[model samples]
Target: MKENVFYGKGMGPIKRDFPDIYEAIVELNDAVYTGKVIDYKTQKFIALAIAASNSDDRAVKKQIQSAINEFNATKDEIMDVLRIVLLTSGMPPFVKAVKILYEVME
Candidate 1:
């Protein structure tokens, strides 16, 4: 993963105003994303699928970007995840996430 590539809203304010809490959160994230057994790339794909299922456009885009930039994730891998989203979450979020994926790729 990259050094300073956290993808979340309001992190700047949280890091500045509440440094301890921010550090704790970062530490937790690090622990969770340690790539033990599952690997970080697959974890990112899971996160992407979850974001797509939730219809969170920004998070989906961010996940796609991070996967590509950090893990060199291919279109096929992302499409595979989106296929799961289509089955589990239905069309709306699946289509929305697919659109975001294309936009990010472009």
Candidate 2:
């Protein structure tokens, strides 16, 4: 219901211009973030991985910030997740993630 600064630039405008889509997105975020089986911290890592895999820099930074703010995620924890991204998604995404990782983790 409230504006999510976590969603990054342009999202507020999108919410105003396309409320239906935004609502659906919010619902999806709620569903995924509930962490029915995985637990919230683990889900945050997964979300971070997904963001990296997609090469969505905004989402990557958002997830990183959220995980750090909410879970107090450490640099090692973030690197661990990025390692998985590297192994599965290859080098480029992993490198990008590593760059953002340092930007946020410090």
Candidate 3:
């Protein structure tokens, strides 16, 4: 089966019901993801860290998978991202992101 790109179960209806909001969200995602001062790979890692810090499992998983699949991020590289989480957010979010990392890496 294809990996579910839609992170949340409820997002589909929101996209359908509020096309304008969904379009705006997509535009924002594209804007932030574009290459600027930061390279794309590093940008992805930053996004991963942000997602991990937020302790959103689906976001963490998606970011992790994106890093791995797009940038071929290694285990060590992932650990490097999570270290920031450990430092700023504490162990709970770090551990949760780690768990999500493992789930996606599997």
- Which one is best on TM-score? 1
Task: Show model 1 residue runs off by greater than 4 Å.
Answer: 2-4
Q: Name every residue pair that clashes in candidate 3.
A: none
Candidate 1 versus the native: TM-score? 0.94
lDDT of 3 by residue, 1-106 (tens): 1122456677798799998977887777777767778788888788789888999888898888878887789988999999999999999999999988888778
Preferred candidate (lDDT higher): 1 or 2? 1
Q: What shift in Å separates residue 59 of candidate 2 from its native position after superposition?
A: 1.5
Clashing pairs in 2: none
State TM-scores per candidate: 0.94, 0.82, 0.81
lDDT of 1 by residue, 54-95 (tens): 999999999999889998888889999999999999999999
Q: Write the per-residue lDDT of candidate 2 for residues 1-106, one digit (tens) a residue.
A: 2123447677788799989988888887787678678887898899899999988888999888888888888888999999999999999999998999888766
Cα lDDT, all candidates = 0.90, 0.84, 0.83
| lDDT of model 2 at position 54 | 87
Candidate 3 Cα deviation (angstroms), residue 93? 0.9
